[model samples]
Target: MINKIVAIQGNHPSKLNSETDTSVFLAHEIQSKNYKIFYYDPKDLSVINSKVIASGFFIKFNYKDKKFFKILKKQKLNLTKCKFILIRQDPPFNLEYISATYILDTIKDKVKILNNPTSIRNVSEKLYSARYQKFMPSTIFTQNISEIKNFFKIHKKVIIKPIHSYGGNDIHLLNKFNSKLINQFIKRHDHIMCQKFLPKISKGDKRVFLINGQVCGAISRVPKHGSFLSNMSKGAKPINVQLTKTEHKISKLIAKDLKKENIFFAGIDFIDQKLNGDINVTSPTGLKTLYDLSGVNLAKIFWKELKA
Candidate 1:
């Protein structure tokens, strides 16, 4: 008999917020279909005697309970025996993350892995969007101090982001050129992304969900008072929104491209109808928030497209 198991490679459950977490939302959806969830951290994955084994526990998520998740049992699991595996970890995309993908690569053919292990490794979340730079704000990816200075001089106001960081952490908006700050930022984050700041960001940004290379649905995230970041992990408020004609065109083009790259699911952002330079393929989020804002459930769409 086929094991009715879906393994999730992610952080510990205590660190995950069930209300806004896409992993939890997805786990909940699949669990209702009678699939058992095997929860494990990427650090615990190992290739033992040519078998991909993961040290984790079976879990059940209860959205209605104050305590959201219940860990049933702790054991080592042979991942190849599972029907599907979901890489649901958040990113700093460090070496450990890359190594996990490499290990998963071994058994990818045997088990269905969402967003394909090899594809996620090959695609740098921010760098992959460089192909669509014409649709993005004036942006540059570098760690060179002189180059950053030149870009800042040209743009006047700029937004600086760590290339591998996620969830709006270590992102800064600079209105003035400060040599010390630039040096410090480069030292901390190696290569960084610098973009021309759009003042209209106060209005909000649109997050478009792409599933199976199709433009599934989208939601608007409005930054909290005085903040410029639109990540929901920050205080951004999510609301229902419609894509403009231009937004739809851009999204469709990107969705097709990502699908070609073997990415099963993704999320892209837009500001004032221009691409925001983030192609969130590593661990794309916002499904739960999107469902809460709009009755449209992309989780259902995600699984339906996968036929998992």
Candidate 2:
């Protein structure tokens, strides 16, 4: 018999705000289905006596209200006791994140781990897109200053981002390359991704949500006035939109491959139908926003795919 317990490895309530969180939306959806929602932070994961365990709470939530949650109980659990584990933490994907994956991988034989710990570890959110270069904008991943300069010279306008960074943080849109700043950026991030800036972004980049290798819904997040970053967290506004044929094709390709990688869910972006080179596997968001804009609650589709 399958255990009905679902453990989510993520931040606590005090650190989350429902307005911008997908974890709460996802957890709430699962809890509403009568599954016990156990929560823990990646830091709370440990390997004790060869058993992977987590210390956290059994939570329940209702999204109908602004304050959307309640902790029904708190306890330490051998992760193997869980029927499923959702790795929902935001990324910088530091050492702690890597350690948590190692611990979770141990109990993966007993508990179904979403996105598959080994697959998640092997897939670099940005760098892994290298395989789909033909579908992407002109992008170079390197630490070499000269290579970046050469790429800038060819592309003219460029965006520089860290291979490991997320939430649109540390992303720079450059009309003209600055050697000093570029060098400093390279110094700060171990491996950097520099791509041709798509002026088409003025129209907005589309975030396509995929669940279990299928396109469930999508939304266009238009950048705030005079901004190049389209991240909703950066003040972008969501607009209901339909995917172009090419966008759907590219997204489906990535979706099928991610499924092959055992990635249960993911979100990818497109700027004028060109892959943005950031496969958001770490913690794919915008489900709530998509629901609000398109009235498609992929959060419901999410649990259905997992059969939670």
The residue-level lDDT of candidate 2 at 199 comes to 90
lDDT of each: 0.93, 0.87
Count clashing residue pairs per candidate: 0, 0
* Per-residue C-alpha lDDT of model 2 across residues 1-88, encoded as one tens digit per residue: 7668888888787688787688888877777767888899888887788888788988887767666778888899988888889898
What TM-score would each prediction reach against the true structure? 0.98, 0.96
Error (Å) of candidate 2 at residue 72 is: 2.6
| Each candidate: RMSD | 0.9, 1.3
Instruction: Name the runs in model 1 displaced over 4 angstroms.
Output: none
* Strongest candidate by lDDT: 1
lDDT of 1 by residue, 1-308 (tens): 76999999999999988889999999899899999999999999999999999999999999999999999999999998898899989998999999999999999889999879999999999999899999999999999999999998899999999999999999999999988998999999989999999988899999999999899999999999999999888999898999999999999999999999999999999999999999999889989988888777888888888787
CA lDDT, candidate 1, residue 201: 87
